[model samples]
Target: MLDTDTIGYLAATFTTTAFIPQAWLTWKTRRAEGVSLMMYSIFVVGIALWLLYGLLSHAWPVVVANVITLMLASFILLMKIVYK
Candidate 1:
């Protein structure tokens, strides 16, 4: 059986890494026309809360994943703002 930490690590790895392509494409193209500002705004806030929850629970995987995701989402948000 997988330990909780192992499960967390796997979940974190997949979920956090999922945003890489979108982030890279957005950054590389410098275009966020199709990106929704409202969605990303809400998403970053949720990610922030998730990070806070992880910190409180001492879940390193959750904390790390949220941090990286927040960065990527924030970058996309910034792109939406800047390129819009």
Candidate 2:
């Protein structure tokens, strides 16, 4: 049988890590000219909801990944506004 915990951690970590570079680039460059604020706003909100769901369900993988992603996404969104 597949280990759900292991799968969750791996998938979450990979997806969340994939987002890091884009987030870091946006923050470092402060040029989100090509990025869609509306898209990211919705995405971040969705991630936040996922995080909440993870917490309620006591899922560490979901919780950890979404929390980090939330921070990164929120940072980029803020930079998008501030730098614009």
Candidate 3:
């Protein structure tokens, strides 16, 4: 059976990894015209708050996932800005 931390990390991996394709595609295509700036703006903020929460709670999985997710979300947001 997986431990709590293991499970947490697994969950984190899935959610965080899920964004990679979108980030990569945006980075490569330089076309975020289809992306919504308002959504990403809100998403980045939410991810930052999640990172803070993870830090306060000492949840390594959450911290790591949120950090990476934040980066991806921010990158997407930046792409949107640049491409818009």
Candidate 4:
């Protein structure tokens, strides 16, 4: 049986790795015309909360995932602000 930490680790890996490409694309393309500022802002806040929770829980996977996600999301949010 898979342990809880193992599961979280795997889940976090997939979830985070999934975003890196998109973030890289967005970073390279610098396209935010179709993106919504409100949505990205809300998402960034949520990710930040998750990061905090992950820190409090001392979950390595959660912390790692959230850090990357927060970085990506914050970049998108910044693009939203700068573009729009």
Q: Give one clash count per candidate, in the order shown.
A: 0, 0, 0, 0
Q: Tell me the lDDT of candidate 1.
A: 0.94
| Maximum-lDDT candidate | 1
Runs of candidate 2 with Cα error greater than 4 angstroms are none
List TM-scores for all candidates, in order.
0.95, 0.91, 0.96, 0.84
Candidate 3's C-alpha runs over 4 A off are none
Model 2 scores a C-alpha lDDT of 0.88
Worst-scoring 10-residue span by lDDT in model 4: 18-27
Instruction: List the candidate numbers ranked by lDDT, top first.
Output: 1, 3, 2, 4
Expressed as tens digits, the lDDT of each residue in 1-84 for candidate 4 is 999889988998888777677667767888777777888888889999999999998988899889988987787778767766
Candidate with the larger TM-score of 2 and 4: 2
Off by over 4 Å in 1: none
Q: Candidate 1 residues 1-84, lDDT tens each? A: 999989998999899889889899999999999899999999999999999999999989899999999999999999999999
- Kindly report which residue pairs in candidate 1 clash with one another: none
lDDT, candidate 4, residue 3? 97
Off by over 4 Å in 4: none
Model 3 agreement with the true structure over 1-84: per-residue lDDT tens digits: 899999989999999998899999999998998899999999999999999999999999999999999998899899999988
What are the lDDT scores of the predictions, listed in order? 0.94, 0.88, 0.93, 0.83
Residue 1 lDDT in candidate 4 = 100
